[model samples]
Target: MPTSICKACARLMKEKEDFPRGNFDSDYCASCVDHKGNLKPRDIIRVNMIRYRVNNTGVSEEEAAEIVDNLMRSLPAWNKPKTPTT
Candidate 1:
């Protein structure tokens, strides 16, 4: 039998998994499915920073502090990648 490979993670699947009302088809494995399910921390940070900046425009200090705290709790999932030398 021919197998379908995921374009994102390149995992093979035998058939499409079906939902109750519709079909949610994918060639990726379960791990890849779970991995892509949520936002990366950096991405969350980037969005929250924008939101905080907008919400803090001449706002109350307490509100601004709250926004900053909410943004800070979303950090620490990423680190700079190290380059390999020949």
Candidate 2:
């Protein structure tokens, strides 16, 4: 079986259900994309991740925020350099 990591949430995608719209070519997971297969805003994903961690892992909100921040920074989607607007 092939596996891929979601660029937005770091979710391990081992099955078709794990990918957004069940598309294996997608770099993000279902949780990270909208129904149209567009990636959600970074802040939205960040908040969702933090909430998930706090609820599932029994972690403090602050701790989850910190952990998510570090994790997002290491992810390809969030780690890329930002471009300046013209």
Candidate 3:
């Protein structure tokens, strides 16, 4: 069986797993994208979302920091990547 890594969140998935119909050549994993191939606003993948918000929004630095803080809180307490036990 071939394993695939999500382009956005780096989550591992089965390559033969069914992907939503569109995005014919897309390399993203289902958790990172929606049925329409749009990035999902999930805590598991909040890093890029926060960056995009801070860079593209008109909010002040303080507000941006607060937003980032919120996003940080949304993440699980232990987010370290999964590793196989020896």
Query: Considering every candidate listed, which one attains the maximal TM-score?
Result: 2
For residues 1-86, write the lDDT of model 3, one tens digit per residue. 54555545444556545243433355566656776777666554565545556679976666866776664443332233633322
Better of 2 and 3 by lDDT: 2
- Candidates ranked, most accurate by lDDT first: 2, 3, 1
> Best-fitting candidate, measured by lDDT?
2
| Per-residue lDDT over 1-86 for candidate 2, one digit per residue giving the tens place of the 0 to 100 score | 56888888999998988887679889899899999999999999999999999999999999999999999988878876842312
Instruction: For model 1, name the residue pairs that clash.
Output: none
TM-scores of the models, in the order given: 0.25, 0.88, 0.35
Give the clashing pairs for model 2.
none
Flag regions of model 3 displaced more than 4 Å.
15-25, 41-44, 47-86
Write model 1 residue lDDT over 1-86, tens digit each, in one string.
33554332223445444211122444333333344443334444445444545675866656655765564443222222432312
TM-score pick, better of 2 and 3: 2
- Model 1 C-alpha lDDT versus the unseen true structure: 0.41
CA deviation > 4 Å runs, candidate 2: 82-86
Score candidate 2 by lDDT. Answer: 0.89
> How large is the C-alpha RMSD of every model relative to the true structure?
13.7, 5.0, 10.4
